[model samples]
Target: MPAKKPFALRLDEKMMQAVEKWAADEFRSTNGQIEWLIHEALKKAGRLKDTKEGGRMKDEG
Candidate 1:
């Protein structure tokens, strides 16, 4: 696992509730769900490059 940095995140009350519900449905914590969502979006957009070591962002020139 890579190091994780903590940061403050503001979300609308309703949206937060929805995310919490979705997370429970998926048997994951809200934070994990958020991370998974971000990972999926990045993969879909070709932002996440897979390396021999594993999934990691490509190095910038």
Candidate 2:
């Protein structure tokens, strides 16, 4: 697994509630759901590059 950096995130109460509910429905932790959402968005936007190990590669450039 790649190293993960932690950061503070502030969300509206309603949005946080919605994300919590969605995470529960998907059997994922709220943090995991957020990460998945971001990863999916990056993939859709062609911002992620797949590696031979089937993992995402970070653009260090």
Q: For each candidate, give its TM-score against the true structure.
A: 0.79, 0.81
Give candidate 2 regions above 4 Å deviation: 52-61
Winning candidate number (lDDT): 2
Per-residue CA lDDT of model 1 for 1-61, tens digit only, reads: 5799999999999999999999999999999999888888887887865653345444321
lDDT of each: 0.82, 0.85
Clashing pairs for predicted structure model 1, backbone only = none
Give the Å shift of residue 32 in candidate 1: 0.6
